[model samples]
Target: MMSFLPQLSLPLPHHCSSSKPFQNPTVIALRSPTTVSNATTDSGIQFRRKLLYLRGLNVNALEALRKNPEFRSTPLRTLKSVETCLASMGIERAALGRIFDMYPQLLTCDPYLDLYPVFGFLLNDVEIPFPDVRTAIIRCPRLLICGVDDQLMPTLWFLRKLGFVGRQAITCQTTVLLVSSVENTLLRKLEYLRSLGLSCSEVANMVLRSPGLLTFSIENNYRPKVEYFLREMKGDIVEIKRFPQYFSFSLERKIKPRHKLLLDHGFSMSLSDMLKVSDGEFNLRLTKLRLRCLEEFPSAEVLLLNNLFLISVLTPKDWKRESSISCFYLYQLPLLDVFVYWLKILGCVNPLIVLDFYTFPILQFSSIIFIFLKCS
Candidate 1:
């Protein structure tokens, strides 16, 4: 009976424990729950760090884990599946870091339930083409985090009602606007524009023409620009309705500088002419205006120095071909000297040239010089 019983390990007696406390071999052989739990936790953390490192998210992996609690417990395979899903939709491996960094909650999102539905809505409901699906996501990464039923569907409905359908339908280029809140963001901007003496239809037309109008902030962008347009430029609201892109131009950089330049020269330009052109083109147009001013009013020789300097800098081939003047001649000559030289060249061909400053407007003066230059 004793032999049949299993042999048991016994603890050492305190008296026979040599200098040590009595110990049980069985107890020493097993690990505590805390130790096992700690080992598991450490392994899980290391695995997550490796996963993020492999996916280019090492830059902010710890921050992501801390911020998104779901990420800490999410299975390794689930995180990989999210990456695989985005990759299938044309999101580049490099772009994944930036997207995840911006929205770390996406790390734990179920690909089928959370991510694929957004892609489907973009492709099917928004009518975004397959290739442009990547563009929309890259442009507005928040689109993935937004719920299709709560955020995206409601926004799309509001936009369609506001006349974003047909040719002016929301496309990949303007898909970023879809993430904006309908009550807090989109409607507020529309109502603000309407409050500025524009009818609802007029505001809708402006937004259709320039979708970026909806993105402008009321305090930072809309208020200041509208105030400047009315107070300083005395701009007509009708112009803004026709060219809503007027709001897109920087108030400090493009609007003020160009508007001041035109005011200094006693000239007025449409918002399109003032802002729609490049810096070089604007300078060329200003120089042309000064040239017209000089020819119309010979007494205004002061215009020549500034105008000639601009001509020297912005020397178009057409001017060189028309004048037959070398670059050195234009650069070196004083305003009066250049004016005299031009007159001498014109006198040879149109000896009977007449000056009528009062009859013709300053803008038409360029035609007179072109006529003489062509005849020569």
Candidate 2:
């Protein structure tokens, strides 16, 4: 009881000695190791890549990884394996949805929006369903759709919601093609393409669908399409490829009870060749024409027109007397002017001739006419 007054706080140094030196207080620098920073850099790299992914450039990241010395040694094949990963960064939601059943986890990830190459082929029926699809359409201002039937209409409608309607969203600048089958589908696709500022090419494989489209009609329609492809896109297309069921012509004209055309749903010709061939059926009956690559025309080859028109003329000069071709139709010829000059010397005037000249600039139309007029 004597000193009860301040027994209060005799500094208990034993209990509170500088907070026990923080337990590990030797002042451990707290600096991260280079390895830790490197690991962090890796995470930062992925984060940066995520930025690119959001910007719709995942491909560039992998491409850089492939070229960068640090990761260049990684197997290139693995890149393909990671395509799904990269594609998921900004690829079309509809396309992702197509494969969603297989990879359910990807549905929640953000998609990269790409303006696909303009000349690409669309072989499958790509469905852009509601809600999320609408968001996707809002992202891609211009889109290309191919394949037969109404499968692409949903995408069009989805796009329409994004203020891409009536040639505003899609116009001659946008392309929507319907492959060989489905009549109504072609009309729908054409309407959609025209709306998105695109004009569809009546390509070799897809021409038959545009009804009342004669050779000349097809050619006329094709010219602008070709020009658009050449000018705006420098010859490219948006693709929606699918496994096509290609059919081949029957060797026999008579339909075999069980035989059908071979099924191949892919490109069969080079880009230029495809353009040339797409206009083929149009001008089915040409007269007084100059052709380039006459030898390359399948029609000429099939009917032996080259052999009939040129080879026949090459026979003995006396045979030339019997080789008078009035109202001649030439296909795939390159030297039309020269051939015409030769024909003029032989007194072949007023003959109705059909021509399918090949590999020349359409801009030369005026010069060609002047030449023809001078020769006439």
Best-fitting candidate, measured by lDDT? Answer: 1
lDDT of 2 by residue, 1-376 (tens): 7777666534544656754443644565666698789988887776564435423522344444433434333333333333454343345434433333333222232223221221121212232232333244333322322222343455445444433443343332232321222244444444533443434442212323322221122234434444444463343433211100111112133112111211021112223222232222212212122233232333221233432343222212222222333333334356666677786686654222333243223332312211111112
lDDT on C-alpha atoms for all candidate structures: 0.75, 0.34
Screening candidate 1 with a backbone cut-off below 3 angstroms (N, C-alpha, C), the clashing residue pairs are none
Among the numbered candidates, top TM-score falls to 1
Residue ranges of candidate 2 with Cα displaced over 4 Å: 1-29, 32-58, 62-284, 288-376
Worst 10 residues of 2 by lDDT: 240-249
Instruction: Give me the displacement of residue 33 in model 2, in angstroms.
Output: 5.3
Q: What is the TM-score of each candidate against the true structure?
A: 0.72, 0.21
- Quote the lDDT for 56 in model 1: 66
